[model samples]
Each structure stands twice: as structure tokens, then as C-alpha cells.
Target: MNFTTQRIEDIVVFTLNETKLDANNSGLVKAEFTLLMKLESVKKLIIDLTDVESCDSTGLSALLVANRLVHANDGDVCLVTSSEKVLSLIRITQLNKVLSVFDTLTDALQELKSK
Candidate 1:
């Protein structure tokens, strides 16, 4: 699997298992995540990119789709990653202002909980 998901209470966390989130698998990522958003019980989502070494535009698009879905459902979404490359791409694309990003899984979860 490209990612593993664990749901605790109302928050769902997706831990990417792939090293690169590029065109090849971004569609799969988007499709699966979209389905998660439809789960009415899910109130928040945390995407953990700890294993993702890099990402492309398509990967970023997938993230955006998740964000939109969450918001449409009146929920929140957060990202957890330590990759400088991924973080840089997010900044360059000006998505940093749109998405909440954290350095650790704990931080993301805590922020989501507090919100």
C-alpha cells in the first residue's frame, strides 16, 4: 500500500509509505483520501508525510482535494512532515497559508484536537 490509515475517534491519520508522491501514484492517493472525507464520522484529518521524500504538483493537488473535502464537510485538515523538499514546495506554491503543517505527528494531532 502507498499509505496506511488509522482512525482514532474523529481524527483520521494517513501515514504515507511511499518515498515519492508524484504523478504515478497521486491519483490513487487522491481517490482514497476523497473516500475518507465522505465518512461522516471523520471530523479531522492528519496526513503524515514522514516517509515521503518529495512531491510533485500532482501530489500537492491531491492534498488540496483532501483539504476541500474536509472543509466542505465542516472539518479540519493538517499535515505532518519533516521533509525540507516537500515543505519548500508547499511554500513555493503558496499553499503554506492554506494548509496547517506541523513537524511532528503529535503536534498535528494536538493542534487538530485543540481546534
Candidate 2:
């Protein structure tokens, strides 16, 4: 998994630098989320999936894992993506109701900041 992380105050921004988030790499992403949630003690998280053009069920599972982890600690997680396919999948799965979705990193950060 190619990624980078940034911290703004208490929020951690995880930028996944991959064109496809599928079964091939979703496990690593899930592991990283667990590590970030447990070891780093991250409460608020922003998953920047701008580079991810495609996603599979495994990818969505990884996101749910992140959401579960953060919310378990009384925190929140948001996803930022400009891919229409990704957005459609979220809507089709009704994950839009469960996860916060944003069109840009700035938008996600602003919302998370307010919370």
C-alpha cells in the first residue's frame, strides 16, 4: 500500500496513493488503520482517496474497519474522493449514511475540525 499520513491537531489524514483499492491491497490498508487507531491513538481520521479511481468490496470493508475503530473510541472518520465510481458505490451500498463522504480534503478537514 502506498500512502502518507499527516496530523492536524488531533486529526490524522491518511492519503492512499493508489489508483485501485481492491483485494490486492485492502488488507494492508486495514492493518494500517488498526495501527493508527491503536498505536497512534488517533481519534479523528480523514481517508484521502482522491487517487483511488476504483474500489472493491474489500476496499469498502477496509473503510468500515477504520470507521469502526475510530468510532469505538468516540471518534469519527471521513472519506474524501472525487471518483464518481467510488461515490456511486457508497450510495448503492447505503454507506453514505454510515460514513462521511466529501469531495475534497479541505471539505473533510473542515467538517472534522468543527466536530
Every model's TM-score: 0.94, 0.98
What's the number of clashes in each of the models?
0, 0
Model 2: per-residue lDDT, tens digit, 1-115? Answer: 7999999998999999999899999999999999987788878999999999999999999999999999889999999999999999999999999989999999999999999
RMSD of each: 1.1, 0.6
**Tens-digit per-residue lDDT, 1-115, candidate 1:** 5689998766899988999989999999998887776655566999899999899999999999988888877888899989999999999999889889999999999898887
Write down the lDDT of every candidate, Cα atoms only. Answer: 0.89, 0.94
User: Model 1 — TM-score against the truth?
Assistant: 0.94
Best by TM-score: 2
Off by over 4 Å in 1: none
C-alpha lDDT (0 to 100) for residue 73 of candidate 1? 79
Span of ten consecutive residues with least summed lDDT in model 2: 34-43
